[model samples]
Target: MSGTTRSGIPLADVYTAADVTAEPAPPGTAPYTRGISPGGYNDRMWVMGQYGGFGSAAETNARFKRLLDQGQTGFSVALDLPTQLGLDSDDPRALGEVGRVGVPIDSLADFETLFDGIPLSQVKQIRTTANSIGPLWVALVTAFAEKRGTDPNDIAIFIQNDVLKEYVARGTQIFPPEAGLRMAADVVEHTAAHLPNWTPMALSSYHIRESGADAAQEVSMTLSNTVAYLDEVVRRGVDIDQFADKLFMFLSAGMDLLEEVAKFRAARTAWSRLLESRYHAGADARALQIFSYTAGSSLTAQSPHTNIVRVTIEALAAVLGGVQTLNTSSYDEALGTPTLESVTLALRTQQVLAEETSLAKVADPLGGSYVVESLTGQILARVEADMDVIAEHGGALRCIESGWFAERLSQQAYEDQQNVESGARRVLGVNCFIDDSTIEVPAFSVDPSAEEQQRKRIAQTRADRDQSEVDVALDEVRRAARHGENCIGSITAAVRVYATVGEIYGVLREVHGPYTAHTGLG
Candidate 1:
């Protein structure tokens, strides 16, 4: 290779054991650079998850059944902008946005409808893209389990509760950073004590990567954010060993085969070392649960069929990288929400890898390669250097508050785009391949009635619910938010009364106020 990798790491012509800087180790050992599981996919294939959800709850529920019927090992739900912001479908702010991006959940009734006919224990795990309303989502899940007469301990939930990323990457943050961190930690504390099978949060680098962070920046920023969360939770009396194992990671699997695999190994090395050094967490706590989604940013609009090949490469990278779970992107995602055909094909892509190919039979098949091992050490050094900058700037929280973090990412994003536009980088079908004809593919769209139906459903729920009970429940939530207490219990009480998602968050808004974005630190 003559040029640099996507993250700007130089590629060497030839490599040997001497080129590798990091010490070699076997699978399932300390630092975990080679791999996490000794048996790897032979012990069990990485959990195959397909992420999807859009339109009304009933519509989303039917889609969930489709994935379940297809033998999806895990289910991942993508909530709409309104629900992610904790707004009801009827709210004026949600008028044009209800069910636009993903499923709209306004009340507990909508939640039940979202998973109707699908049992809580149907999949190995169920995950959601809930940040600002993460605790409320967990509360709804547990309440649903109770209503279905299932033991809460029997189910597993992996929520994307890392709100700090929202502050740095973009918007949709409901509370200020400090308050948001506190609430995110509350979910961890509550889940550790109550739902042992659940993953409180997935420190997410996926969005950061999608927002234009290179591989090294992605891992560094994510780890810095992880440190901030650990400090806050431990201050609240959460024992590190007890809840550290509950930590999960959500990362992007990009098309750089060597770099992606190297990034994965280096991330594990950093995480395992951090836990051992900081809190004296044992092996179990250092072992991370990683859920990966193939990079949607790599999909192209022209010659959409090419995406099938693109996603396959990314998915293979994630597998070879030793991720515990994977979600392959649909080929038609660049055009619109994926159609049933495309979604099924995406699921089949993973099935073919596991069953047909012998890819899953070995543990770290590329572990001994000179190029991969050298790249792994290089990526880790870059990550640590950047992490040192974060620490020097007074940590993740200060960087965000001062807008240094946001500004740095913006500059990096601009530089990355400039490289592509200037022909320094080539994107197949986009820049290099001159395809004049448009290739059409079937695309899925949310139903127009989904919005109106969601509104009426929430209105009906509000009327049918006992007013006095809901009032009491919401008051307690207000009290918890005001008193700096863990809001999970109060949120759960409110969820049981069929309280609207907007209602609970509305009480929180009254206490914490709406969040406004910070301008860059100059």
Candidate 2:
């Protein structure tokens, strides 16, 4: 049999032990390339996280219960762009966007509405796509703790707080990269001290891939950002072990199953080595490097039903890749956010894998394969080369500031699109197979008046809350920002005083200034 590389490099007929890196240590030990857990899924299966979004808080909460009832182990919450960017639903820029893509959150009141019946203490873990609104995210968590009658120390949160990538790729950033990094570090330090069970910042490569990065580029960029965060936190005098263990990873599992598995394995190995060499973090800090995977940007829009088959394959790759958590994307995501049915199908995909397939019964089943081991080594070597480039460009922050990162990804994306359009890349049912007769596609519709209703809600929230209290909270937060105090505490104080998400963000906007995309650097 013959094999090929992801970038079309020809694979040799065989590989020896020397071809692969020397086994640094045993599985579940330091430098965990073999695997993070020796028992693997035999001990505990990966946390099966499903992404759910809907137009209304009531609708989203109902679907969340339905998914949990169907055996989902973790919950991933998707907020609308305005909410994620810390805009009140009533803002003019937010007019046409509220609840169009994800759930609309206007205030602490809307947050309360979203998780009304669900008890936070009983849930395993919760993930959010929050970046620019990092302070608001902290506030919301604090409010949840108050309502649930549990200490903020007990609740678990995995916020996608990678602000540099948000500005450079996703277009959801509200502040400059410097201020954003400061907020992420604040979350890291705060969660380490208060919420030991929580994962505060999830350095996300999933969106970088969605922004059109290839496997090697995605791995390199994400790991570089991770190292940047580590450097910042250590420079701020936070101990490496104190916050490194709290740093989780959010990655993507694309159509390349073997490459995906190899990527995860290599990522953990590289991360472990980086920590050991750079910071001298202990085994416990390096061993439990939590990773979560989402379905990638490879799936299509035409034959939407085929995306189920696509997502199942991607989920399997994540499982085999030893992900600690996984989020299966909806089949109908291309058109818009997922409907309840599509979301449930996504959740059930993981359930079937967890319960029916013996896939979870073994760990690192591909650990000894000649092809997989060889590919893992190749991927790591490429990632290291990419890292050298990032370092030469003065790290990820400088790369983004220089626009080199975006230019490279844009070229890759254009090539990928060209490949698909020219039939060089065959996406089944899209560029090939051309089956118009056998398709029974589901009709997806976002709530027609969701934007209007969201605006009214935001207006009513502004009218209802005491303006004097809001002023006091914002002033205190601004003072904290100037003094270089932990912004998490200031955010919590503001939210306790009933400050809206928009108001809290407005304070940061005044202090930190918004990010402007660089055009000339490319």
Pick the lDDT winner: 1
Q: For candidate 2, lDDT tens digit of each residue in 183-259?
A: 88888877777776778788788888877787777778988888878888888888898878767777788878888
Write the residue-wise lDDT of candidate 1 on 238-266 in tens digits.
88988988887888999999999989988
Model 1: how far residue 73 lies from native, Å: 0.9
Model 2 spans > 4 angstroms off: 1-3, 13-25, 288-290
Residue 332, candidate 1: C-alpha displacement in angstroms: 1.1
Q: Note the Cα lDDT for every prediction shown.
A: 0.88, 0.79
Worst 10 residues of 2 by lDDT: 1-10
- The weakest ten consecutive residues by lDDT in model 1 span 513-522
Error of 1 at 289 (Å): 2.0
Residue 429 local lDDT, model 1: 78
| Model 2's TM-score against the true structure | 0.95
